[model samples]
Target: MAARPDKLVIAISSRALFNLGESHRVFEEQGLQAFSRYQIERENDVLEKGDAFPLVEKLLKINELLGGEPRVEVILLSRNSADTGLRVFNSIEYYGLDITRAAFCNGESPYRYIGPFGCNLFLSADGVDVRRALDQGVAAATLVAGDSRKRRDDVLRFAFDGDAVIFSDEAERIYKREGLVAFTKAERASAQKPLGGGPFKGFLEALQKLQAEFELDSCPIRTALVTARSAPAHERVIRTLRAWDIRVDESVFLGGLPKGEFLRAFGADVFFDDQPAQCASAAEHVATGHVPHGIANVDA
Candidate 1:
């Protein structure tokens, strides 16, 4: 059985939650000492919102919608040490975000603490941290920086890719290795065989439970499956969802088309895809999360 899904917890990197382009550049151009000094000196400078800021805001609002029971929590995970991360915490206070806990990892990756934190989802700017989190079977993605905005309604929209993200890359591996024809044949033959759940499955399950807290017509969260599969190739996807007993507000089978415009039309708060090309294309129009899993990300 899947884990309980009553509440949701998110682990987000400092760079993903707020704009750290300048600080990151310092670290890249100079070195750790220069980066530390830069952060410490600018401790009072409030950070700007990053690509995943809107999504994080919406996630926190769920607790407000639920009469402040704190059903959702956002934990900060950063590469900065406690001294340097003070600015980030100050920015959180300035923004009035409800985030309270954090892990200041000095100059190391902060992915190791996600398990202890019981995070349902992990979003980071570093692909390395995101991949490490996903490898531990936690839902993780690298937030793509872009100019995407939230929908007009209060609903939090989440869009996901099919293979290597929501579902295992079994079919994708077949397609990548043998070709589309063989993949189609394989999927059609195994349409009834449920695909293994990927890293995001648990997070999706928790999100569904959260949605159940509100009425369907007035729910504040909406989800979509925006994939590059269409027609006869879509059967296994439908069957897979049915097998999992999960519901998606929308499912678009693009069958190899670009996803940016479609995501824009859907007003997605964020879209997660395994392919960097797709993430780049989607980031052109919507907030995107690059899930570095499966065969498409073999080189990543």
Candidate 2:
């Protein structure tokens, strides 16, 4: 294992940090050699910002607010070899991102490096890599190139789905096996039992650590739990959060309504959900990441 830093470390792919769609297309259609030549030919050209650029920008801004103490660190994990990755570094310098550490995996999935880097969260354009990270019990999200509109840069807001994201898919499995009526009954009966922690649990805890650095009223970070749960189902989620001792600034129980408009209203920087439908909706409003885990992803 690599040295784990005490800071809140975030691991992001090069494609997530910058727009690499053109070059990625080259790799997909042509192959690695063509992609390598293409990148080398344009090594000096600065890449445009990707969907996650705004979110990454705001996350790094936290360090600036802390007087350069760098309580948060973002790492670059890419499939590009060092030789072909010069353009990425060049663009990073051009954007003036504070990121300094990276792992050039040379066309390999970079998920293996997550533990060594002590990543509280990992985001990637590649769904395969994201799934691999989640399999290792790391909080990972597949970044969706949604609206890409930049929001207020001062406060970084995050939203998450309850089951299969913040909590285990146990309840989700029950819901799948049994009908909604039975699932609701089961939840109501076991309301006192704390649901198992999901992948993003550690990441949320890390955010709490960072939040501790500032006053609650002034903290620039906000989190929300937006779920399809309503009425009796909401109690279990509330009790589960209480049991875990985690703090979410806002908890919206959508109870099967579309979440995009609500997420837009919340001014979320990024929203995480296991359901593609929910993610697609949220992406229309803000940056969204698909957590391909649990029952929703059993066949996925």
Candidate 3:
């Protein structure tokens, strides 16, 4: 029999690890306020005294809740010099991280940022840069993890947006570059048509293949569509997903209202959208990924 593939591999910066507020309670009990300071400095600094233990514990818990299914590798990226890197490494070792993989990227490495190392989930504290990475095809998120119950295998909830995410942003782009009047007229004229595919298309196809590997009824991966498009415009969204043979278990048409509340209620492990406003709000309440669109030139 072929050997089973290695569990999912995650590469996280130290900042990403501590930014998780849900796990903050543990750190608070230990009398550490690492998050606030890190946010204020806007620099990747080493943990204060006794700060490393709680952060490492949170990482271990995240791994455990995922059934230890994903082997997590953390890379500490800081603006400090070699001495600071050595201190951070020493603290990590003192805290007992089974970290077989790590590296020290000079502060400049942030500018050379491509994407996370083969991780489906990339996170960043800087919104603009994160979005830029996403637009370039990196599935990136704000560096925040929530404290929620480990999701059951029974109801796997997946959610998506309409424009620029699940569907081509061409219309939105035209709308942005032109005017609302022209955009509405164009959308109405093409009401019976579908736009070109979006980034998630290939990933959705991979999901379909994975679904076929397991029986649908027993399949744990459930999907949903949560978008601002309402009514007449909604038809194309539904049809597009159907045409792709992808199944969404739950869907909501918010029509310009914020998606944070609905996304929180949905209890998603990871949510992806292209809008920074929506992603910022959702990231506060959930593991949110900002799908970057049209910001590639900035990174380039």
Candidate 4:
């Protein structure tokens, strides 16, 4: 067996892995029994691709560049029970994905198993599950609808939010409870202290390790920090990344500006943010993931 030192493990849910909007609608409108029956009836039907499918396919293809060493592993962590999950497995086999591990949680949140699997990232359509995973200090995102662009076989670009998505939400909590003034003061006062790691820290580390394997000019991955923090608040973010030794190719501190246009211009493969408003806006131009974490999602 190949060594697993540099492996990047991603856990994905059924709905995020494939286009199950119709089936999900059935489940929402009717009930679990109807949904199970529907899935069983359409067991052989190949599911259409969803937003995260292209990203997963591309990540898996990266292994081919590594001489088939299997540097990436994608696990299916779904809320569907084993009986109703046959359709998803069949679809995976039909697509020829190299995914062999899976967990059918029936109605439970699959995030509970992410830690046990040592997954670097988790993508799901369930907001609650994503939030739970984030609270548990795991890198997780709730995938939302986005522009259905065809997948490219070139470089992969990842865009991440600042608070709660990449770094901890301490400043975000202050910002939420107080206001921008108090938040800025808090950040400036603590400029020297590196903020705590957020849910996506582990995933970033994995990608950084992968990036190190290749030369800078020829690296297949590029990362960006697209945050709403600006000026004085930006100092803390820079120090935090520097402290972590993570390389960010691009940094855009928008200072509360709309991020949709910038994300569109960047041509990101996927954008992850904690705020739903930003995710909804970015989804207009590019694929977006909602990280339901930190103070922004405390009420939700």
Best by lDDT: 2
Q: What C-alpha lDDT, on a 0 to 100 scale, does residue 289 get in candidate 1?
A: 92
In candidate 3, the residue pairs with backbone N, CA or C atoms under 3 Å apart (3 or more residues apart, or in different chains) clash, namely 135-292, 223-249
Ranking by TM-score: 2, 1, 4, 3
C-alpha lDDT of candidate 3 relative to the true structure: 0.55
Give the alpha carbon lDDT tens digit for every residue of 185-281 in model 4.
Answer: 9999999999999888878888999888788898878899999999999999999999999889899999999998898777788999989898999
In candidate 2, what are the lDDT values of residues 1-300, reduced to their tens digit?
A: 432446888899999989999999999999999999999999999999998888889999998888756898899999999999999999999999988999998899889999888888999999999989988878999998898677745899989999999999999998999979989999999998999999898888888878888888889899999999998999989998888888899999988999999998989989999998888888889899999999998787
What's each prediction's TM-score? 0.96, 0.97, 0.60, 0.92
| Minimal lDDT window, size 10, model 4 | 1-10
lDDT of 1 by residue, 49-134 (tens): 88888898998988999885688889999999999999999999999999999999999999999988888999998988888888
> Which tens-of-lDDT digit does each residue in 1-300 have in candidate 3?
111123223344555544334324433554334433433343344444321223334444434444534443444444334543454565566557655555455443341334434433345555555555456564444443443333544344556766776677887776667866677677777766767777665445544544454565765556667887766556767776777767777889887788878887887656778776677677676666567664222242
Ranking by lDDT: 2, 1, 4, 3
Scored by TM-score, the top model is 2
Better of 1 and 3 by TM-score: 1
By summed lDDT, the worst window of 10 consecutive residues in model 2 runs over: 1-10
**Model 2 steric clash pairs:** none
Over 4 Å off, model 3? 1-11, 20-103, 110-119, 128-132, 144-158, 177-185, 207-213, 295-300
lDDT of 4: 0.86
